[model samples]
Target: MEETEQKVGMLGSGSWATAMIKMLGDNQKKKKVLWWIRKEEDLNYVRTYKHNPTYLSAVELRIEPKNLFTDARDVIRQSDIVVLNTPSAYLKAALHGVGAEDFKGKLVVTAIKGIIPDENLIVGSYLSKVYGIPAENIVVIGGPCHAEEVSSEKLSYLTIAAKDTVKAERVASLLRNRYINTVLSTDVYGVEYGAVLKNIYALAGGICHGLGFGDNFMSVLVSNAIREMETCLTAIDPEADRDINASAYLGDLLVTAYSQFSRNRTFGHMIGKGYTVQSAQLEMNMVAEGYYASACIHNIIQQYDLELPICNMVYQILYNKQSANLEVNNLASKLS
Candidate 1:
């Protein structure tokens, strides 16, 4: 690897992580994309085959074999930009031995769509508070794009957000290619919270779908969700001048809430069909961001004294042991 080339380190090997590696590789192989694969077996397989053995198996990996590392700190130590792509629930564990200084001067990008599980904080905030990384150095990836579609080389859109426009543009430039188009935003608060809230709404949509609700009600549910999202976002950050209809907010909400590839919706569908949370997780072999986000967002709602009916409904069903049928029915009457 040339020392002059930009080194980008990837911290997760899940479907989204693999898709990002694909985007970066597609944008330019000159970036020297380094990946931290958690499992040694997966690492060996990718090294040997040039494709992730488990996630996004069909998409050919554009990463160089020599850049794969099992230790996350090692990857962070070498890269100019570090991406945190692991599920938010497991993020703390993923950075096990790394210290704040390891991230001192690096640009940290978050592709995580969920809040930090027990922390009740968004990934960007968590990075700032825990690692001492400044807000300007962090970039957030927002999407209406699905990893499955990205793997298939379908055109998808991602929003790159940061407090600093220069950093956002740099990350956007790295991620954009023929299959992926990028938009840059400075509303880090709005984009991050919107991404987290969409999952809960998507899970709610899935539960409604599993309960046999027709498209008419689903449309009503979505319309109300976007309003609820706008309310919550504005309350959370009164200074952010967000449109709420941008690709980062409403567009992402629409896709996650309706897309067939949405794991959160799938998880909610299973829950509506009487599957336990543990069972649904085991069956899907994927983490539904909403399952955790439901609880986290619920906490945020209470702390902020914000009344988000859609998110409240999801929280009740998932964490309160309430009947999905009854909770959603009550919610339906409340939706305009």
Candidate 2:
């Protein structure tokens, strides 16, 4: 048996993808990683601008100009570690052409934080079922790291989760960068569940901001989000870490909840101010994962007949056409 060379490949070229490229580029053990962008136009734009100017303004991320692609299969075939950062709404469609049979012997990690609408499946769940990939083979990168902040060179932390503790450690070791730190978690489902649920809460936080509520009000919502996370996690896997109140969980909750850079938060703010979901998403020129996630999680909650107050309010605001302000106020009063 000879030493196997490790190569990294990432799918998607959004803000998160760009930031991830920079982080992976710092790996001395690995010289370069393959990044698959959706369009040649996006590849050209990043090659020239050195930043994803369309979304992340302050974070300057430039690739080697050679490590970009429009073809997904080509990149997938050549890399040993494939990191998926595509938005969840389009992830199924995105993987349509790529054959998972050829992807044997590769370590597939999910960098996406979303629950697929209607399907009500996390990216990891979808991959496991569709690709016959083991839960350990598909590590989920969860916790608090934000693409916007990473682009701006701000320090952040994240959790790498897999059923195999050793495999999770392998991802965590390769994932660390100057400003980014990653830890391994055995509770893969719990961590990913927290990551997905937090997106919905971030939208709620934005609605609170748009409704003219202060930090005090947002703090309550954030706490409520954690409670929701705990409930959802316990339903999926009891004995999951309860200390998610840490930086990775609550810390990520704060950034996505409050940051002007969060598309989900911004989308909610627009809805709170009277824009419809379609209009808000179009105006922002980005997919707010929370918008789709709120709907998806709501369906899951209803199917299980579970009570998720914050996510339910978000569903009412986006799907049921309820007033964001009124629903948030009602939710706040309930928690109060």
Candidate 3:
């Protein structure tokens, strides 16, 4: 198939998925971009209104009405490249009826930044192991980019990592625009794991903020968080040769830890401000990837016996019924 003739499909109807649609619509090549929205209401709304009514409503969609779909299998069958942008906790449900055969010979790109809950595997690894997709055919998208900023056309950077550089570059080409810059890498393991770990650190930052910790303390907390992230990523894939300070790793951490649009930070702030886990989740009305990640990472790290104090503190507060004030205060003592 010709490069320009290859069809691309987006799976998910959230803010990030909306942002990706906007990016692809802006691509000069103008390839067909198929979108799989989980809800019939959202699909009808986007087709009728040219915008996602619930998420990133302000970004006008340029998708052709014929390309929007409510069926996952139909979208998967029609597109040569499929981008999975759902929250990691809901990914299994999103692909409920999708089987290995549906993904055969297609390139799968993951924009999810959290680990698959019970499996404790990153998206790229999970897809390869469960769906029979080859590692070389999977691409992972990492961001210092937020959906809100992308919707507003603010400048942002993205890292596309895959075992195959050619595939990574091809995917990057589809997303690069005037406001979006792309960098390509071969460290799929490090990029995906870094994306997952950063959310946990962001939650820690939010908890500290809710507890009234100052900017001075935040600096130390994040510095240590990056080091902790490096420790964990290295343990997972020591041969990756990735730079922890790059946009995909440290930059992503900074944005999620401080951005007003960061749902994870918002969720953590709610928890720190005396709301119970149930109450915080109820009020946010969004999935804080870090909340699910806290437990998954806590479980994964046990096998490595790594010291991830920030992740541990978050897990305690959210899952173990520990006091946020007490847990964050104790965490402060350990930070250098």
My TM-score estimates for the predictions, one after another, are 0.97, 0.92, 0.98
Q: Rate the local accuracy (lDDT) of all candidates.
A: 0.91, 0.78, 0.91
**Residues 1-336 of candidate 2: C-alpha lDDT, one tens digit per residue:** 654556788898777877787787664444457878787776788778766555565556645778777888888888878998988887776677887685788889998888877678888888877787776688888757777677767887888888888888777777687888887777778777777877888888877787888888888888778888777777767876657676656777777887878777888788878888888877986778887788777767877778788999999988889977789878977784
Q: List the RMSD of every prediction in angstroms.
A: 1.7, 2.4, 1.2
- Candidate numbers, best TM-score first, in rank order: 3, 1, 2
Superposed by TM-score, candidate 3 places the C-alpha of residue 114 at a distance from the truth, in angstroms, of 0.8
Candidate 2: pairs in clash: 59-151
Cα deviation of 255 in candidate 3 (Å)? 0.4
Candidate 1 clash pair list: none
The digit string of per-residue lDDT tens for model 1 on 205-231 reads 999999999899999999999999998
Please report how far candidate 3 places residue 40 from its true position, in Å.
1.0
Candidate 3 lDDT by residue in tens digits, 133-171: 999899999999999999999999999999889999889
Q: After superposition, how far is residue 42 of candidate 3 from its true place, in Å?
A: 1.4
Candidate 2 deviant stretches above 4 angstroms:
1-4, 45-66
